[model samples]
Target: MAKLQQTLDDVRSIELDNAFYVEDGTWIESLTVASNTEFDPETVLEEISGVSLFYSSKIPTASEELEIRRLTILANESYPFILSLILRQEAIPNRIVLQNDVFEIVATTRDWDQFRSMADEVQETLGEFELLSVTQNEEPGEPLDSGRLTEVLVSKLTSDQLEVLETAYNHGYFDVPRETSETDLADELDITQSTINERLRTAERTLLELIYGPRE
Candidate 1:
Protein backbone atom coordinates (compact mmCIF):
# COMPACT_ATOMS: atom_id res chain seq x y z
CA MET A 1 0.00 0.00 0.00
CA ALA A 2 1.11 3.56 -0.65
CA LYS A 3 1.98 5.65 2.39
CA LEU A 4 0.53 9.17 2.50
CA GLN A 5 1.95 12.03 4.56
CA GLN A 6 0.09 14.96 3.05
CA THR A 7 -2.38 16.93 5.16
CA LEU A 8 -6.04 17.43 4.29
CA ASP A 9 -8.15 20.41 5.35
CA ASP A 10 -11.79 21.56 5.41
CA VAL A 11 -13.37 18.17 5.09
CA ARG A 12 -16.83 17.25 6.35
CA SER A 13 -17.84 13.83 7.66
CA ILE A 14 -20.53 11.54 6.35
CA GLU A 15 -22.32 8.95 8.46
CA LEU A 16 -23.40 5.65 7.02
CA ASP A 17 -24.77 2.36 8.19
CA ASN A 18 -24.41 2.02 11.96
CA ALA A 19 -21.26 4.18 12.16
CA PHE A 20 -19.87 7.60 11.21
CA TYR A 21 -16.47 8.49 9.57
CA VAL A 22 -14.78 11.10 7.40
CA GLU A 23 -14.02 11.25 3.73
CA ASP A 24 -11.30 13.60 2.61
CA GLY A 25 -10.99 15.19 -0.80
CA THR A 26 -7.54 13.67 -0.96
CA TRP A 27 -6.17 10.37 0.34
CA ILE A 28 -6.05 10.32 4.13
CA GLU A 29 -2.75 10.57 5.90
CA SER A 30 -4.13 9.90 9.37
CA LEU A 31 -7.44 9.58 11.27
CA THR A 32 -8.42 9.71 14.93
CA VAL A 33 -10.76 7.58 17.01
CA ALA A 34 -12.35 8.46 20.31
CA SER A 35 -11.70 6.16 23.23
CA ASN A 36 -15.44 5.76 23.60
CA THR A 37 -16.26 4.89 19.99
CA GLU A 38 -15.78 1.40 18.65
CA PHE A 39 -12.68 0.77 16.58
CA ASP A 40 -13.70 -0.42 13.17
CA PRO A 41 -10.65 -1.31 11.08
CA GLU A 42 -12.75 -2.02 8.00
CA THR A 43 -14.41 1.37 8.11
CA VAL A 44 -11.08 3.04 8.63
CA LEU A 45 -9.30 1.28 5.80
CA GLU A 46 -12.25 1.89 3.54
CA GLU A 47 -11.89 5.62 4.07
CA ILE A 48 -8.12 5.69 3.76
CA SER A 49 -7.30 3.20 1.04
CA GLY A 50 -10.76 3.50 -0.50
CA VAL A 51 -11.11 -0.24 -0.21
CA SER A 52 -12.60 -2.47 2.47
CA LEU A 53 -10.20 -5.29 3.18
CA PHE A 54 -12.00 -7.01 6.06
CA TYR A 55 -15.36 -7.74 7.66
CA SER A 56 -17.75 -5.24 9.31
CA SER A 57 -21.18 -5.58 10.80
CA LYS A 58 -24.14 -4.40 8.74
CA ILE A 59 -27.01 -4.96 11.16
CA PRO A 60 -24.80 -4.30 14.15
CA THR A 61 -26.35 -4.03 17.55
CA ALA A 62 -24.84 -1.63 20.05
CA SER A 63 -23.48 -4.53 22.07
CA GLU A 64 -21.96 -6.06 18.97
CA GLU A 65 -20.00 -2.92 18.20
CA LEU A 66 -18.77 -2.68 21.73
CA GLU A 67 -17.81 -6.33 21.57
CA ILE A 68 -15.74 -5.68 18.47
CA ARG A 69 -13.79 -2.95 20.21
CA ARG A 70 -13.20 -5.28 23.14
CA LEU A 71 -11.94 -7.93 20.74
CA THR A 72 -9.45 -5.49 19.21
CA ILE A 73 -8.08 -4.54 22.57
CA LEU A 74 -7.88 -8.20 23.54
CA ALA A 75 -6.01 -9.11 20.39
CA ASN A 76 -3.50 -6.32 20.92
CA GLU A 77 -2.90 -7.34 24.51
CA SER A 78 -2.72 -11.04 23.71
CA TYR A 79 0.17 -10.31 21.35
CA PRO A 80 1.53 -7.02 22.49
CA PHE A 81 4.78 -7.95 20.82
CA ILE A 82 3.24 -7.12 17.49
CA LEU A 83 3.70 -3.56 16.29
CA SER A 84 0.58 -1.38 16.26
CA LEU A 85 -0.27 1.90 14.57
CA ILE A 86 -2.91 3.93 16.40
CA LEU A 87 -4.72 7.19 15.67
CA ARG A 88 -6.15 9.05 18.67
CA GLN A 89 -8.57 11.97 18.32
CA GLU A 90 -9.75 14.82 20.49
CA ALA A 91 -13.07 16.64 19.95
CA ILE A 92 -12.71 20.14 21.38
CA PRO A 93 -11.32 21.79 18.26
CA ASN A 94 -11.23 18.66 16.16
CA ARG A 95 -7.62 17.49 16.23
CA ILE A 96 -6.03 14.14 15.42
CA VAL A 97 -2.83 12.61 16.58
CA LEU A 98 -1.10 9.60 15.16
CA GLN A 99 1.06 7.39 17.35
CA ASN A 100 3.53 4.74 16.52
CA ASP A 101 5.67 3.10 19.17
CA VAL A 102 8.28 5.72 18.32
CA PHE A 103 6.69 9.18 18.03
CA GLU A 104 3.49 11.20 18.26
CA ILE A 105 2.14 13.60 15.65
CA VAL A 106 -0.25 16.40 16.65
CA ALA A 107 -2.34 17.55 13.75
CA THR A 108 -4.46 20.67 13.54
CA THR A 109 -8.23 20.85 13.02
CA ARG A 110 -7.51 20.17 9.36
CA ASP A 111 -5.85 16.94 10.33
CA TRP A 112 -8.74 15.08 11.89
CA ASP A 113 -11.22 12.71 10.28
CA GLN A 114 -14.16 12.54 12.66
CA PHE A 115 -17.39 10.71 13.26
CA ARG A 116 -20.62 12.68 12.76
CA SER A 117 -24.04 11.99 14.25
CA MET A 118 -27.09 14.24 14.26
CA ALA A 119 -27.76 13.60 17.93
CA ASP A 120 -24.16 13.97 19.11
CA GLU A 121 -22.26 17.24 19.38
CA VAL A 122 -18.51 17.67 18.80
CA GLN A 123 -16.80 20.37 20.84
CA GLU A 124 -13.18 19.42 20.23
CA THR A 125 -11.16 17.13 18.01
CA LEU A 126 -9.04 15.71 20.79
CA GLY A 127 -11.69 13.96 22.84
CA GLU A 128 -13.30 10.60 22.24
CA PHE A 129 -11.68 10.06 18.82
CA GLU A 130 -12.65 7.17 16.60
CA LEU A 131 -10.41 4.23 15.73
CA LEU A 132 -9.16 4.44 12.18
CA SER A 133 -7.20 1.87 10.21
CA VAL A 134 -4.27 -0.16 11.43
CA THR A 135 -1.34 -0.20 9.05
CA GLN A 136 2.41 -0.92 8.70
CA ASN A 137 4.16 2.11 7.26
CA GLU A 138 7.73 1.53 8.41
CA GLU A 139 9.61 2.52 5.35
CA PRO A 140 11.27 5.77 4.25
CA GLY A 141 9.47 8.71 2.59
CA GLU A 142 6.21 8.00 4.32
CA PRO A 143 5.26 9.88 7.48
CA LEU A 144 7.52 11.33 10.10
CA ASP A 145 7.67 9.17 13.21
CA SER A 146 6.51 6.46 10.87
CA GLY A 147 8.21 3.55 12.52
CA ARG A 148 6.14 3.12 15.67
CA LEU A 149 4.90 -0.28 14.63
CA THR A 150 8.37 -1.19 13.46
CA GLU A 151 9.69 -0.07 16.82
CA VAL A 152 7.27 -2.47 18.45
CA LEU A 153 8.72 -5.18 16.27
CA VAL A 154 12.22 -4.02 17.10
CA SER A 155 11.43 -3.99 20.79
CA LYS A 156 11.13 -7.74 20.48
CA LEU A 157 14.55 -8.07 18.85
CA THR A 158 18.04 -8.01 20.27
CA SER A 159 20.11 -4.88 19.63
CA ASP A 160 22.06 -6.55 16.82
CA GLN A 161 19.02 -8.15 15.16
CA LEU A 162 17.21 -4.84 15.43
CA GLU A 163 19.96 -3.24 13.43
CA VAL A 164 19.47 -5.76 10.65
CA LEU A 165 15.70 -5.34 10.70
CA GLU A 166 15.92 -1.56 10.61
CA THR A 167 18.32 -1.73 7.71
CA ALA A 168 15.94 -3.97 5.82
CA TYR A 169 13.00 -1.65 6.37
CA ASN A 170 14.81 1.63 5.66
CA HIS A 171 16.49 0.32 2.55
CA GLY A 172 13.17 -0.74 1.11
CA TYR A 173 13.93 -4.43 1.42
CA PHE A 174 10.42 -5.02 2.71
CA ASP A 175 8.50 -2.87 0.25
CA VAL A 176 5.65 -4.64 -1.45
CA PRO A 177 6.80 -6.44 -4.60
CA ARG A 178 10.21 -6.07 -2.93
CA GLU A 179 12.33 -3.20 -4.08
CA THR A 180 15.50 -4.96 -2.98
CA SER A 181 16.15 -8.62 -3.67
CA GLU A 182 17.87 -10.88 -1.13
CA THR A 183 20.94 -10.95 -3.33
CA ASP A 184 20.99 -7.16 -3.25
CA LEU A 185 20.83 -7.08 0.52
CA ALA A 186 23.44 -9.79 0.68
CA ASP A 187 25.72 -7.70 -1.48
CA GLU A 188 25.07 -4.53 0.52
CA LEU A 189 25.63 -6.19 3.87
CA ASP A 190 28.65 -8.13 2.53
CA ILE A 191 27.12 -11.32 3.86
CA THR A 192 26.03 -14.48 2.16
CA GLN A 193 22.30 -14.95 1.40
CA SER A 194 22.33 -17.86 3.85
CA THR A 195 23.61 -15.60 6.59
CA ILE A 196 20.94 -12.98 5.88
CA ASN A 197 18.29 -15.66 6.02
CA GLU A 198 19.65 -16.87 9.35
CA ARG A 199 19.57 -13.35 10.76
CA LEU A 200 16.00 -12.90 9.65
CA ARG A 201 14.99 -16.21 11.20
CA THR A 202 16.75 -15.36 14.45
CA ALA A 203 15.04 -11.99 14.53
CA GLU A 204 11.61 -13.49 13.96
CA ARG A 205 12.18 -16.13 16.65
CA THR A 206 13.23 -13.52 19.15
CA LEU A 207 10.13 -11.44 18.42
CA LEU A 208 7.86 -14.42 18.91
CA GLU A 209 9.62 -15.12 22.16
CA LEU A 210 8.83 -11.62 23.32
CA ILE A 211 5.21 -12.03 22.31
CA TYR A 212 4.39 -15.51 23.66
CA GLY A 213 7.12 -15.70 26.29
CA PRO A 214 7.98 -19.37 26.87
CA ARG A 215 4.38 -20.55 26.29
CA GLU A 216 4.08 -21.59 29.92
Candidate 2:
Protein backbone atom coordinates (compact mmCIF):
# COMPACT_ATOMS: atom_id res chain seq x y z
CA MET A 1 0.00 0.00 0.00
CA ALA A 2 2.84 2.37 0.83
CA LYS A 3 4.46 1.66 -2.54
CA LEU A 4 1.13 2.21 -4.23
CA GLN A 5 0.75 5.55 -2.50
CA GLN A 6 4.28 6.53 -3.52
CA THR A 7 3.52 5.64 -7.12
CA LEU A 8 0.44 7.81 -7.02
CA ASP A 9 2.44 10.69 -5.56
CA ASP A 10 5.14 10.36 -8.17
CA VAL A 11 2.59 10.33 -10.96
CA ARG A 12 0.93 13.37 -9.44
CA SER A 13 4.22 15.28 -9.20
CA ILE A 14 5.75 14.36 -12.56
CA GLU A 15 4.97 17.41 -14.73
CA LEU A 16 4.75 19.97 -11.95
CA ASP A 17 5.88 22.80 -14.19
CA ASN A 18 3.24 22.20 -16.85
CA ALA A 19 0.11 21.00 -15.07
CA PHE A 20 -2.20 22.32 -12.36
CA TYR A 21 -5.28 21.02 -10.59
CA VAL A 22 -8.18 22.97 -9.13
CA GLU A 23 -10.15 21.96 -6.06
CA ASP A 24 -13.21 21.37 -8.20
CA GLY A 25 -11.44 18.47 -9.97
CA THR A 26 -10.77 20.92 -12.79
CA TRP A 27 -7.34 20.75 -14.36
CA ILE A 28 -5.77 23.69 -16.18
CA GLU A 29 -2.56 22.72 -17.93
CA SER A 30 0.02 24.26 -20.30
CA LEU A 31 1.90 21.95 -22.62
CA THR A 32 5.44 22.81 -23.80
CA VAL A 33 6.24 23.03 -27.50
CA ALA A 34 8.89 23.94 -30.00
CA SER A 35 8.78 27.39 -31.56
CA ASN A 36 7.17 27.86 -35.02
CA THR A 37 5.37 24.55 -34.93
CA GLU A 38 2.06 24.25 -36.77
CA PHE A 39 -0.70 21.72 -36.15
CA ASP A 40 -3.37 20.31 -38.42
CA PRO A 41 -6.63 20.21 -36.48
CA GLU A 42 -7.98 17.10 -38.18
CA THR A 43 -4.70 15.27 -37.62
CA VAL A 44 -4.67 16.24 -33.97
CA LEU A 45 -8.22 14.99 -33.55
CA GLU A 46 -7.29 11.68 -35.15
CA GLU A 47 -4.38 11.26 -32.72
CA ILE A 48 -6.33 12.06 -29.57
CA SER A 49 -9.88 10.88 -28.97
CA GLY A 50 -10.73 13.01 -25.94
CA VAL A 51 -9.90 16.33 -27.61
CA SER A 52 -11.76 18.25 -30.33
CA LEU A 53 -10.59 21.36 -32.09
CA PHE A 54 -13.43 23.87 -31.86
CA TYR A 55 -11.97 26.99 -33.42
CA SER A 56 -8.50 28.14 -34.34
CA SER A 57 -7.57 31.83 -34.73
CA LYS A 58 -4.45 33.93 -34.55
CA ILE A 59 -3.93 37.48 -33.34
CA PRO A 60 -0.99 39.85 -33.27
CA THR A 61 0.02 40.98 -29.84
CA ALA A 62 1.93 44.13 -28.80
CA SER A 63 4.93 42.67 -30.60
CA GLU A 64 3.75 42.99 -34.20
CA GLU A 65 6.17 40.30 -35.27
CA LEU A 66 4.75 37.83 -32.76
CA GLU A 67 1.44 36.16 -33.52
CA ILE A 68 -0.37 33.85 -31.11
CA ARG A 69 -2.85 31.19 -32.09
CA ARG A 70 -5.79 30.68 -29.78
CA LEU A 71 -7.13 27.15 -30.13
CA THR A 72 -10.22 26.05 -28.28
CA ILE A 73 -10.36 22.29 -27.75
CA LEU A 74 -13.27 20.40 -26.32
CA ALA A 75 -12.24 17.16 -24.62
CA ASN A 76 -15.39 15.07 -24.74
CA GLU A 77 -13.46 11.76 -24.52
CA SER A 78 -9.95 12.00 -26.01
CA TYR A 79 -6.87 11.89 -23.78
CA PRO A 80 -6.23 8.32 -22.73
CA PHE A 81 -5.47 9.07 -19.10
CA ILE A 82 -8.39 11.46 -18.76
CA LEU A 83 -10.63 9.07 -20.64
CA SER A 84 -9.66 6.25 -18.31
CA LEU A 85 -10.57 8.46 -15.37
CA ILE A 86 -13.87 9.60 -16.87
CA LEU A 87 -14.80 6.05 -17.73
CA ARG A 88 -14.24 5.16 -14.10
CA GLN A 89 -16.61 7.96 -13.08
CA GLU A 90 -18.54 10.98 -14.28
CA ALA A 91 -16.37 13.87 -15.46
CA ILE A 92 -16.46 16.79 -17.85
CA PRO A 93 -13.71 18.31 -19.96
CA ASN A 94 -14.03 22.06 -19.60
CA ARG A 95 -11.32 23.47 -21.86
CA ILE A 96 -7.98 22.90 -23.54
CA VAL A 97 -5.26 25.32 -24.65
CA LEU A 98 -2.87 23.90 -27.23
CA GLN A 99 0.32 25.33 -28.66
CA ASN A 100 2.74 23.37 -30.77
CA ASP A 101 3.45 20.14 -28.81
CA VAL A 102 2.09 21.39 -25.53
CA PHE A 103 -1.59 21.10 -24.62
CA GLU A 104 -3.35 22.84 -21.75
CA ILE A 105 -6.49 21.11 -20.54
CA VAL A 106 -9.22 22.14 -18.10
CA ALA A 107 -11.39 19.28 -16.87
CA THR A 108 -13.79 18.62 -14.00
CA THR A 109 -14.93 15.45 -12.25
CA ARG A 110 -17.00 15.00 -9.12
CA ASP A 111 -15.76 11.59 -8.08
CA TRP A 112 -12.51 11.49 -6.13
CA ASP A 113 -12.29 7.73 -5.87
CA GLN A 114 -12.62 7.43 -9.62
CA PHE A 115 -9.99 10.09 -10.04
CA ARG A 116 -7.55 8.11 -7.95
CA SER A 117 -8.26 5.02 -9.97
CA MET A 118 -7.59 6.97 -13.14
CA ALA A 119 -4.30 8.20 -11.70
CA ASP A 120 -3.22 4.66 -11.12
CA GLU A 121 -4.07 3.76 -14.66
CA VAL A 122 -2.18 6.79 -15.94
CA GLN A 123 0.88 5.70 -14.02
CA GLU A 124 0.72 2.38 -15.78
CA THR A 125 -0.27 3.61 -19.25
CA LEU A 126 1.33 7.00 -19.97
CA GLY A 127 5.09 6.75 -20.18
CA GLU A 128 5.87 9.77 -22.33
CA PHE A 129 4.35 12.54 -20.19
CA GLU A 130 4.16 13.30 -16.48
CA LEU A 131 1.36 14.06 -14.01
CA LEU A 132 2.04 16.99 -11.74
CA SER A 133 -0.43 17.29 -8.85
CA VAL A 134 -3.95 16.39 -7.93
CA THR A 135 -5.78 19.05 -5.98
CA GLN A 136 -8.84 17.95 -4.05
CA ASN A 137 -11.69 20.39 -3.99
CA GLU A 138 -13.02 21.58 -0.67
CA GLU A 139 -16.37 21.78 -2.36
CA PRO A 140 -15.83 19.95 -5.63
CA GLY A 141 -15.45 22.25 -8.68
CA GLU A 142 -15.82 25.47 -6.70
CA PRO A 143 -12.91 27.88 -6.52
CA LEU A 144 -11.57 28.12 -2.99
CA ASP A 145 -11.15 31.89 -3.15
CA SER A 146 -14.53 32.62 -4.70
CA GLY A 147 -16.99 34.72 -2.72
CA ARG A 148 -20.42 33.51 -1.73
CA LEU A 149 -21.93 35.92 -4.23
CA THR A 150 -20.07 34.30 -7.10
CA GLU A 151 -21.10 30.83 -6.00
CA VAL A 152 -24.73 31.84 -5.81
CA LEU A 153 -24.50 33.42 -9.24
CA VAL A 154 -22.99 30.37 -10.88
CA SER A 155 -25.39 28.07 -9.12
CA LYS A 156 -28.34 29.90 -10.62
CA LEU A 157 -27.24 29.28 -14.20
CA THR A 158 -28.85 26.34 -16.02
CA SER A 159 -26.81 23.86 -18.07
CA ASP A 160 -28.27 25.20 -21.35
CA GLN A 161 -27.35 28.75 -20.38
CA LEU A 162 -23.82 27.71 -19.58
CA GLU A 163 -23.56 25.79 -22.85
CA VAL A 164 -24.65 28.74 -24.97
CA LEU A 165 -22.35 31.13 -23.11
CA GLU A 166 -19.38 28.82 -23.51
CA THR A 167 -20.16 28.20 -27.18
CA ALA A 168 -20.24 31.92 -27.88
CA TYR A 169 -17.02 32.52 -26.05
CA ASN A 170 -15.26 29.58 -27.70
CA HIS A 171 -16.34 30.51 -31.24
CA GLY A 172 -15.02 34.05 -30.79
CA TYR A 173 -18.46 35.54 -31.19
CA PHE A 174 -17.50 37.88 -28.39
CA ASP A 175 -14.15 38.82 -29.94
CA VAL A 176 -13.56 42.34 -31.20
CA PRO A 177 -13.80 41.47 -34.92
CA ARG A 178 -16.06 38.50 -34.13
CA GLU A 179 -14.59 35.30 -35.49
CA THR A 180 -18.10 33.81 -35.71
CA SER A 181 -21.69 35.02 -35.80
CA GLU A 182 -24.92 34.01 -34.05
CA THR A 183 -26.20 32.33 -37.18
CA ASP A 184 -23.00 30.35 -37.52
CA LEU A 185 -23.10 29.41 -33.86
CA ALA A 186 -26.73 28.40 -34.17
CA ASP A 187 -25.99 26.19 -37.13
CA GLU A 188 -23.05 24.55 -35.37
CA LEU A 189 -25.25 23.77 -32.39
CA ASP A 190 -28.15 22.69 -34.65
CA ILE A 191 -30.39 25.09 -32.71
CA THR A 192 -32.51 27.97 -33.97
CA GLN A 193 -31.17 31.53 -33.87
CA SER A 194 -33.97 32.65 -31.54
CA THR A 195 -33.18 29.92 -29.01
CA ILE A 196 -29.50 30.74 -29.01
CA ASN A 197 -30.26 34.45 -28.61
CA GLU A 198 -32.53 33.83 -25.65
CA ARG A 199 -29.97 31.68 -23.89
CA LEU A 200 -27.22 34.25 -24.38
CA ARG A 201 -29.44 37.04 -23.14
CA THR A 202 -30.44 35.08 -20.07
CA ALA A 203 -26.87 34.10 -19.32
CA GLU A 204 -25.72 37.71 -19.73
CA ARG A 205 -28.45 38.96 -17.42
CA THR A 206 -27.52 36.42 -14.77
CA LEU A 207 -23.85 37.43 -14.99
CA LEU A 208 -24.73 41.11 -14.79
CA GLU A 209 -26.85 40.47 -11.74
CA LEU A 210 -23.89 38.76 -10.12
CA ILE A 211 -21.73 41.80 -10.84
CA TYR A 212 -24.19 44.62 -10.02
CA GLY A 213 -27.11 42.95 -8.25
CA PRO A 214 -30.74 42.96 -9.38
CA ARG A 215 -32.22 46.08 -10.91
CA GLU A 216 -34.17 48.35 -8.54
Candidate 3:
Protein backbone atom coordinates (compact mmCIF):
# COMPACT_ATOMS: atom_id res chain seq x y z
CA MET A 1 0.00 0.00 0.00
CA ALA A 2 2.84 2.39 0.88
CA LYS A 3 4.58 1.67 -2.39
CA LEU A 4 1.35 2.28 -4.30
CA GLN A 5 0.83 5.60 -2.57
CA GLN A 6 4.36 6.64 -3.34
CA THR A 7 3.86 5.79 -6.97
CA LEU A 8 0.59 7.71 -7.17
CA ASP A 9 2.17 10.72 -5.50
CA ASP A 10 5.06 10.58 -7.92
CA VAL A 11 2.70 10.47 -10.88
CA ARG A 12 0.76 13.45 -9.59
CA SER A 13 3.89 15.44 -8.84
CA ILE A 14 4.61 15.63 -12.54
CA GLU A 15 2.30 18.55 -13.39
CA LEU A 16 -0.83 16.51 -12.62
CA ASP A 17 -3.48 18.06 -10.44
CA ASN A 18 -3.71 15.50 -7.62
CA ALA A 19 -4.00 11.76 -6.94
CA PHE A 20 -5.11 9.71 -3.96
CA TYR A 21 -6.70 6.42 -2.97
CA VAL A 22 -10.44 6.52 -2.35
CA GLU A 23 -11.37 3.08 -0.95
CA ASP A 24 -12.11 -0.41 -2.30
CA GLY A 25 -9.11 -0.45 -4.69
CA THR A 26 -10.15 2.43 -6.91
CA TRP A 27 -7.96 5.38 -7.97
CA ILE A 28 -8.99 8.72 -9.44
CA GLU A 29 -6.94 11.67 -10.63
CA SER A 30 -7.06 14.81 -12.78
CA LEU A 31 -4.70 16.86 -14.89
CA THR A 32 -4.06 20.53 -14.47
CA VAL A 33 -5.09 22.57 -17.46
CA ALA A 34 -4.21 26.10 -18.40
CA SER A 35 -6.91 28.73 -18.02
CA ASN A 36 -7.10 29.16 -21.77
CA THR A 37 -7.20 25.47 -22.63
CA GLU A 38 -10.40 24.38 -24.29
CA PHE A 39 -11.98 21.34 -22.70
CA ASP A 40 -13.93 18.87 -24.78
CA PRO A 41 -15.51 16.09 -22.71
CA GLU A 42 -16.09 13.91 -25.78
CA THR A 43 -12.42 14.11 -26.68
CA VAL A 44 -11.39 13.12 -23.17
CA LEU A 45 -13.78 10.17 -23.16
CA GLU A 46 -12.45 9.07 -26.53
CA GLU A 47 -8.88 9.27 -25.32
CA ILE A 48 -9.45 7.32 -22.13
CA SER A 49 -11.19 4.17 -23.29
CA GLY A 50 -11.96 2.42 -20.02
CA VAL A 51 -13.07 5.42 -18.02
CA SER A 52 -16.60 6.81 -17.95
CA LEU A 53 -17.31 10.45 -17.25
CA PHE A 54 -20.26 10.64 -14.87
CA TYR A 55 -20.51 14.29 -14.00
CA SER A 56 -18.60 17.41 -15.16
CA SER A 57 -19.31 20.77 -13.63
CA LYS A 58 -17.31 23.91 -12.95
CA ILE A 59 -16.73 25.15 -9.46
CA PRO A 60 -16.75 28.61 -7.76
CA THR A 61 -19.06 29.55 -10.62
CA ALA A 62 -18.68 28.24 -14.13
CA SER A 63 -17.72 31.44 -15.89
CA GLU A 64 -15.33 32.48 -13.16
CA GLU A 65 -13.42 29.22 -13.20
CA LEU A 66 -12.69 28.19 -16.74
CA GLU A 67 -9.50 26.29 -16.00
CA ILE A 68 -10.97 23.88 -13.45
CA ARG A 69 -13.81 21.38 -13.87
CA ARG A 70 -14.89 18.77 -11.42
CA LEU A 71 -15.18 15.40 -13.12
CA THR A 72 -16.30 12.03 -11.77
CA ILE A 73 -14.94 9.07 -13.72
CA LEU A 74 -15.63 5.39 -13.18
CA ALA A 75 -13.14 2.77 -14.30
CA ASN A 76 -15.08 0.41 -16.52
CA GLU A 77 -13.44 -1.25 -19.56
CA SER A 78 -9.70 -1.27 -18.68
CA TYR A 79 -8.58 1.55 -20.90
CA PRO A 80 -6.53 4.55 -19.66
CA PHE A 81 -3.74 1.94 -19.38
CA ILE A 82 -3.49 2.54 -15.63
CA LEU A 83 -6.88 1.00 -14.99
CA SER A 84 -5.84 -2.02 -17.02
CA LEU A 85 -2.68 -2.43 -14.99
CA ILE A 86 -4.59 -2.21 -11.72
CA LEU A 87 -7.17 -4.67 -12.96
CA ARG A 88 -4.47 -7.08 -14.03
CA GLN A 89 -3.15 -6.88 -10.48
CA GLU A 90 -6.62 -7.95 -9.24
CA ALA A 91 -7.56 -4.69 -7.55
CA ILE A 92 -11.13 -3.35 -7.46
CA PRO A 93 -11.80 0.31 -8.13
CA ASN A 94 -14.60 1.94 -6.14
CA ARG A 95 -15.28 5.60 -6.89
CA ILE A 96 -13.63 8.84 -7.86
CA VAL A 97 -13.82 12.15 -5.99
CA LEU A 98 -12.99 15.33 -7.86
CA GLN A 99 -12.38 18.67 -6.18
CA ASN A 100 -11.45 21.64 -8.29
CA ASP A 101 -8.16 20.63 -9.92
CA VAL A 102 -7.53 17.61 -7.71
CA PHE A 103 -8.85 14.07 -8.06
CA GLU A 104 -9.08 11.45 -5.34
CA ILE A 105 -9.79 7.73 -5.82
CA VAL A 106 -10.98 4.92 -3.60
CA ALA A 107 -9.76 1.37 -4.17
CA THR A 108 -9.03 -1.89 -2.33
CA THR A 109 -6.23 -4.40 -2.87
CA ARG A 110 -4.40 -6.88 -0.66
CA ASP A 111 -1.64 -7.96 -3.01
CA TRP A 112 1.76 -6.29 -2.85
CA ASP A 113 2.56 -7.43 -6.36
CA GLN A 114 -0.45 -5.50 -7.62
CA PHE A 115 0.74 -2.32 -5.98
CA ARG A 116 4.27 -2.73 -7.25
CA SER A 117 3.05 -3.47 -10.74
CA MET A 118 0.89 -0.36 -10.71
CA ALA A 119 3.81 1.76 -9.55
CA ASP A 120 6.08 0.36 -12.23
CA GLU A 121 3.47 0.82 -14.93
CA VAL A 122 2.83 4.43 -13.92
CA GLN A 123 6.51 5.25 -13.87
CA GLU A 124 6.96 3.73 -17.29
CA THR A 125 3.95 5.54 -18.72
CA LEU A 126 4.71 8.98 -17.36
CA GLY A 127 8.29 10.11 -17.29
CA GLU A 128 9.59 12.23 -14.37
CA PHE A 129 7.49 10.56 -11.64
CA GLU A 130 8.70 10.84 -8.04
CA LEU A 131 8.27 8.48 -5.12
CA LEU A 132 6.87 10.06 -1.93
CA SER A 133 6.20 8.95 1.63
CA VAL A 134 3.31 6.53 2.25
CA THR A 135 1.19 6.14 5.35
CA GLN A 136 -0.44 2.85 6.34
CA ASN A 137 -4.04 2.30 5.13
CA GLU A 138 -4.49 5.96 4.37
CA GLU A 139 -4.03 8.25 1.42
CA PRO A 140 -0.50 9.57 1.13
CA GLY A 141 0.27 12.56 3.40
CA GLU A 142 -3.33 12.67 4.80
CA PRO A 143 -3.71 12.38 8.53
CA LEU A 144 -6.16 9.70 9.60
CA ASP A 145 -8.06 12.09 11.84
CA SER A 146 -9.09 14.32 8.94
CA GLY A 147 -10.31 11.45 6.79
CA ARG A 148 -11.89 9.10 9.33
CA LEU A 149 -15.40 10.50 9.38
CA THR A 150 -15.73 10.56 5.64
CA GLU A 151 -14.33 7.07 5.32
CA VAL A 152 -16.73 5.73 7.88
CA LEU A 153 -19.74 7.41 6.35
CA VAL A 154 -18.71 6.38 2.86
CA SER A 155 -18.46 2.77 3.92
CA LYS A 156 -22.13 2.81 4.88
CA LEU A 157 -23.44 4.42 1.69
CA THR A 158 -23.85 3.01 -1.78
CA SER A 159 -22.11 4.76 -4.67
CA ASP A 160 -25.31 6.34 -5.92
CA GLN A 161 -26.24 7.43 -2.41
CA LEU A 162 -22.83 8.97 -1.94
CA GLU A 163 -22.99 10.76 -5.26
CA VAL A 164 -26.40 12.20 -4.49
CA LEU A 165 -25.28 13.33 -1.06
CA GLU A 166 -22.21 15.01 -2.46
CA THR A 167 -24.15 16.68 -5.23
CA ALA A 168 -26.73 17.99 -2.78
CA TYR A 169 -24.04 19.39 -0.55
CA ASN A 170 -22.25 21.01 -3.46
CA HIS A 171 -25.47 22.65 -4.63
CA GLY A 172 -26.38 23.94 -1.16
CA TYR A 173 -29.43 21.70 -0.83
CA PHE A 174 -29.09 21.75 2.92
CA ASP A 175 -28.40 25.42 3.29
CA VAL A 176 -30.72 27.52 5.41
CA PRO A 177 -32.19 29.12 2.33
CA ARG A 178 -31.57 26.11 0.11
CA GLU A 179 -29.79 27.52 -2.92
CA THR A 180 -30.97 24.61 -5.05
CA SER A 181 -34.09 22.52 -5.29
CA GLU A 182 -34.50 18.75 -5.39
CA THR A 183 -35.82 19.05 -8.91
CA ASP A 184 -32.77 21.04 -9.94
CA LEU A 185 -30.43 18.53 -8.36
CA ALA A 186 -32.22 15.73 -10.16
CA ASP A 187 -31.85 17.58 -13.41
CA GLU A 188 -28.14 18.08 -12.80
CA LEU A 189 -27.66 14.42 -11.94
CA ASP A 190 -30.01 13.40 -14.76
CA ILE A 191 -32.26 11.47 -12.45
CA THR A 192 -35.87 11.90 -11.48
CA GLN A 193 -36.88 14.12 -8.56
CA SER A 194 -38.40 11.22 -6.65
CA THR A 195 -35.24 9.22 -7.07
CA ILE A 196 -33.16 12.08 -5.73
CA ASN A 197 -35.47 12.49 -2.74
CA GLU A 198 -35.36 8.80 -1.87
CA ARG A 199 -31.57 8.71 -2.11
CA LEU A 200 -31.24 11.81 0.02
CA ARG A 201 -33.58 10.45 2.66
CA THR A 202 -31.81 7.13 2.85
CA ALA A 203 -28.42 8.78 2.93
CA GLU A 204 -29.51 11.20 5.62
CA ARG A 205 -30.89 8.36 7.71
CA THR A 206 -27.64 6.46 7.49
CA LEU A 207 -25.67 9.58 8.33
CA LEU A 208 -27.83 10.32 11.32
CA GLU A 209 -27.41 6.80 12.60
CA LEU A 210 -23.67 7.21 12.25
CA ILE A 211 -23.75 10.49 14.15
CA TYR A 212 -26.09 9.51 16.98
CA GLY A 213 -26.01 5.73 17.00
CA PRO A 214 -28.98 3.53 16.10
CA ARG A 215 -32.28 4.51 17.67
CA GLU A 216 -34.12 2.01 19.84
Which pairs of residues have clashing backbones in candidate 2?
12-132, 23-137, 24-141, 31-102, 49-78, 50-77, 50-78
Model 1, residue 118: displacement in angstroms? 13
Residue-by-residue lDDT tens digits, candidate 2, 41-94: 446444654444555544222222222333344444224544334345455544
The reply for model 2, stretches above 4 Å from the true place, is: 1-153
Model 1 scores a C-alpha lDDT of 0.37
RMSD of 1: 19.1
Model 2 weakest 10-residue run by lDDT: 8-17
**Model 1: per-residue lDDT, tens digit, 1-216?**
211111112112211111122333222122222122344455444454434333333222222112211111001111111111122333122222322211222222222244233102322322343334433333313222222333355446665565556557657988887888767777877888887788878987877876688556
As a whole number from 0 to 100, the lDDT of residue 34 in candidate 1 is: 18
Q: Model 3 reaches what TM-score against the true structure?
A: 0.35
Error of 2 at 201 (Å): 0.7
Candidate 3 error regions (>4 Å): 1-144
